[model samples]
Target chain A: MGKWIELQAVPGARDRWVRAEPFGGTVSFRRPEMLVMVDHAFLGQRQPKSATASGRLDPAAPYEAHLTVGHRCTVGCPGCYIDAREDGPAELGFDEWQRVLDKLASLGVFHVALGAGESTPLAFLIDLAHYARGLGITPNLSTAGLHLTPRLAQKLGVFGRVHLSLDGAGRDHMRGRVGFASALMSLRILRAYHPRVGVNCVVTRASFPGLGRLFRMLKREGVVDVELLRFKPAGRGAELFAQMDLTTEQKRTVVQKVLQLARRYRMRPRLDCSFAPMVCAAGYDPTRLVRMGLAGCVGGSWLVAVDGRGCLSACSFDNTAGALSWSDLGRPGMMTPFTNWIDQAPSPCAECRWLQVCRGGCHVVARHLTGDFNAPDPGCPLVQAQA
Target chain B: MNRKAKTKGSVLSVRTGSNPNSSSLGVDVTWLLGGGVLVGLLTMVGQTLTRWALTRAKSKHGQMD
Candidate 1:
């Protein structure tokens, strides 16, 4: 067994040795003086020395935020997670969203994912992206591509990243009759100007079979980065959950296939944190899986979500977190209370083997499945097998 | 210096000798060749064992703490 040690300087000239043990490779370091240490292992497995040395984040700052700009969407897919409707909750006006952006910037959030209902005005999205850029926050836009006009695409050129949603080649059936064609046409147009366009594919049982073909199609289009969002039972998604959710066997197959395809095509595929358990189920080390950035569940900790109505959530799918308005920023703690609330692991999660990596899976998904946020994620094969 | 001179003289004598196929010298050469092969095998085995152990350790424990 290989042994390694890191000595961190603490207050009072004290040195703390963070030792990596031989048997379990467990790392232990405790020093109040250390502002941040990047040496974190996932599922009791140590990462590469470079990863451990470079992984640093300020404890007080959020790494990312998903900001919903509007509540109306045009691509009314049956499985839309937000249950976004034409007549859904009114979106925060441009001025209100600007205040939220300022608050996020003040909180030290570096990246903001701007998404809206499919029907959101393109003008609002462009203005908000520009505003976020002015605040020194790198904005990432997620869109259904229904309204991705030449003017809007040109305006969105300033975005750090743009995620165009596409499920499979069967766009008509997967995303709606018009969504697939429109998204593909927009992607073609955007590629002419934008260099960092990525595809966000929602992995569901119906879409799983066509993933390989879709990946090939994406690679042919010169797109190298694809983020696979796991299907969650939220909003309008719950209605189709029974038919769309992947079985354990299917989950294993899909994960293995995706991993193989990613390597074969030299594509960078990032799975949502909800798929961490699938990696564990595939008998792979979570640490290695995390090197692909697919293992850690950063919800409520590294990232937070704000709905169109100014409601704060641990993630876009998690709406249980209380309302966070512009007025809340005047308080001393601001969003700390909400961040802390969602960041705290439940008692049941302590016993999980993948606790360090998976962070007990998505709390919203757990609550949706078992009717308790504290319950282990029902999607996890380990949790399912236990049950 | 005397030992080296004596060994060189002995080798010259053997090369010029009538009985070139001496059993003693043949045995010594065979023993040296066999010893070399044995050492080579042992070195290979040692290297293989060390590699196996390291791989097993990594797979089981991931990394040392």
Candidate 2:
């Protein structure tokens, strides 16, 4: 049988927002807010998008959202990014969360990536998922999987995908540490609850050695999907950054390994936006990356993360950039400060050929490592090469 | 020769020694091609309708996350 091209709605996205793809992309907007992610754009079949379209700003609502319900953790992973504690920003109560959800829905936001220090402990996580599902807002939850109970998983089964946070294959990173696990047990529990389970691996230097094993383990568990996240240099990670972060060579090697595994597994190999520099380092075509909507810095465009207090920043990782609430979002010339540098690459990036695609990698990573939010991503091969 | 061709009024006729089997075969081939095109178009219409129906049904309740 021949391959059939599908027109699918990006989950929890506007019903009108359709993503038609494979390798190929072109995120074209007919109206200011309507984004059509289709291969026809990459196929050069779309009507010419505005030459100066910027592909960044939209006066309308973001298509995706990241909402951290609370910041209290039962099983605090080593180097916890949010620095959750009893004193940290508390979880929003259901009513408060409802209001935030209401505002997002009113803005026509469709998908919400739900998380916290540990989502399972939130008493109303299931209710929140049910509520978001009721509103046609997809809730993609991620959790530190150690404390998950089957009853909780069963309740969560109704909404959408629940990603368990697992680092490396077995016990590569701090196996005996606080709350992090290999997540194999959580995977087993969730697989029984829902078929759409996936893992989120926080990529570190040790993770490089186990990419093959991690993918192999996931594949054996009837899981083919995982998102590789860069280890942010924040919270406890700030202290562990020098010890845990990948070196430039390791970054390139892991990228190459991911590509090899992706081909073998026929998987998309989902890498976080911060991994864009690594992808670039692996010698992938810049134009292809752009056409693929693999443009590294989409925090301020496609999605933004809201903290428990309802402050909307560019994404989950961007903590320092000033944020705006729903009321302030539509101000005359307001844009997330972190992404303001998206088009206007800072310093060294301004001199690079692939400036537009990589966008100097991740801002938060730079801020934490180089003490300058505007510094070029330290993991980027170009930064090291330029040096 | 397998067959000889002659034209009368811009219509070419193929003649074999005793049977005009090639001419009948040509007619059958034309009909086959025409039927194939008609079937293909109908199938496309049917597939499009099915997909549209599925999408409508999914919008009400779909399998996704």
lDDT tens string, model 1, B1-65? 98753332110000000000100000001111232353344334333333343344446655422
lDDT score at residue A117, model 2, on the 0-100 scale: 63
lDDT of 1 at A178: 51
TM-scores of chain A across the candidates, in order, are 0.79, 0.83
What lDDT tens digits, residue by residue, belong to model 1 across residues A255-322? Answer: 66876777667675766667766656656544433322233455555567788888876567765545
Residue range with the least summed lDDT across 10 consecutive positions in model 2 chain B? B19-28
lDDT of 2 by residue, A48-145 (tens): 45423554323245556777767666555667776665566655678878877776666556567777765336457778877876765666677766
lDDT of 2 at B51: 37
Report how far off residue A65 is in candidate 2 (Å): 1.1
Reproduced native contacts, each prediction? 0.02, 0.00
TM-score of each predicted structure versus truth: 0.69, 0.73
